[model samples]
Each structure stands twice: as structure tokens, then as C-alpha cells.
Target: MRRTSSKYVRHSDEGELLWLRPPTRSGHVFIKVDPTNTSSARMAMGTQQVEVGGRIPVHRHDSQDEILFVYAGQGTVIVGDERAQFKAGTTVFIPQGVWHGVENTSDEPLQVVWVVSPPGLEAMFRDIGTPPGEEAKSLTPEEFAAVAERHGMRVKSH
Candidate 1:
């Protein structure tokens, strides 16, 4: 048997929002489901809007597997050294320890929805991302890598 909860919903703008700075990627990360909002949730879910020409640098989650769904726009994705073009409706699975990254190649922003199992990557975004409306703070590549490492991710150097 599985536990159950009453129906719940989260609007597009109802979740926690964070702004990522350079050295990683300039984008808006919206964390919709995580321990903070759904204690029983076993996975973390969120959406990211990557600015034109911006990219999510190469990185790997050592402890969690991730699934990314391209919701809108187009982009190129690298998974373990293999690159592929992805558009709306494309889904990619990234196993734990596999290096992967996404680059927005289209003129419009690349919209992606990501889910990670074992729940926790949300903490990294919360720690490093600047709150919307606040002056975006910058982090050096090394500093960013350090923060990522603390959260079970290894970011490739730029």
C-alpha cells in the first residue's frame, strides 16, 4: 500500500523562485516541489528558463538521477560527452554521475522542467540562487563548484 494525500496544486508563479548568476547560467529557477513544500515528495521538481545564449554548464549529480523535459524553445544538450538537439516535448534522462548540460540555442528562452529523485537538489538552488528583485550576486567558477560539491553535484570548470 502507498500513502496518500489530498489533492494539491501549484500555479506557475506560486513556487519558490531563484535567479542564477554567471559561472553557472543566468536563468530563473522555479522550485515547485521539494521537501520544503511537500514533505512526502520523494523527488524534487522545478522549472528553469534559460536566457537566450545562456546555458547550464556541465555538471553531474553523484547521488541522484535526473530527468529533464524540454517544455518550450529549442536547445542542445550534452550527456556524457554526447550532444543532441532537443526541442519541445523531448525528454532526457541523466543517470547519476553522468555529466550533462543544456544550452539555449534558439532566440527564445529555453524552458525546461527537471525532476531529481531522492530529493535534495533544491537546497543547492536555494543556497546559491539570488532571490528575484535582489541585486544578482556573482560567483566565481571555483566558488560555484564548491557550492555544488556541497550539494552532491560536481560542476565542470568553464
Candidate 2:
């Protein structure tokens, strides 16, 4: 069974009620979509903004698959042992248990819509991420690994 926040209920106007969570990684900000703010279960959605020169560290979800749609800027997506260029309109799929990460290689920020199936990761982000209006902080490798583990994910060695 999954848990949801009672504060939000999905509707076209729900966007006006959703709160923007803090960055989940260094140089990145995430806007989460889940049962907390949307009528979605089984899946979680969100938008992430990766600053210029920033990168999402290589990692893997043990229990959920992920899909990423690049909405702006350019970057490199590394999945397993392969790397591919991504830009606005590009889409990438990462199977569960596969190692993957993203790097913003352009001067502009990389904006992407991210979705994870079997929704639960959003709770992890909300728990581990810095809150809005607070100073952004980077998690130490050990801390990152701990959080990932708690969320059924693993930080990979690259």
C-alpha cells in the first residue's frame, strides 16, 4: 500500500496548489507530482532543472523504471555503459536496475520531465531534498547512498 498527502487533490487547477520542492541534487531543482498533488498512484512525475555544467550522479532504481523527456537545453544521458546526447524534445527510457545519469553540458540549464512507475520515489525526494527558501546543500556520498537505499535505489560507481 502507498501513502498520500491529504492536502492535494488532482485537477487541472491543481498546479496552482502544488508546492515546489527543493533540489534533489546539486545544481538541480525538482517539482514533484504524486498522489500528494495529483490523482496518480503507481507512478510519480516531476520536472527537474539541472544547471549548466551540472550532472545527476550515476544511479539505479531497484524497483522502478524511469522515463525522461528533455524539455530544454542540451545534455548527455548515460545509461549503463552507453551515452547519448539529449536536447529539447528528446526522450529517454531507463529500465529498472540499469545504471543511469545525466550531465548538463550546455551553457543553459537542462530541463526535463521525469516519471517513475510504481510511485514512491517522490516521498524519498520530499524527505531528502532541501526545502524551498532554504540554502541548497549537497549530500555526502554516504548520505546519498543511505537515502537511495531507503528508497529502493542504489548509487552506482562510475
lDDT, model 1 = 0.87
lDDT of 2 by residue, 37-144 (tens): 666677887767777777787889998999999999998999999999878999999999999999999999888878999886777666566554565456666776
User: What C-alpha lDDT, on a 0 to 100 scale, does residue 151 get in candidate 1?
Assistant: 95
Q: lDDT for each of the candidates? A: 0.87, 0.72
| Residues 1-158, model 1: lDDT tens digits | 11223225777666788999897689889988887667666899889999999999999999899999999999899999799999999999999999999999999999999999978788998878988678887898898899899999999875
Model 1, residue 7: C-alpha shift (Å): 7.1
Each candidate's TM vs. the true structure?
Answer: 0.92, 0.80
Q: Quick one: best lDDT, which candidate? A: 1
Give me the runs in candidate 2 sitting further than 4 Å from their true place: 1-24, 135-137
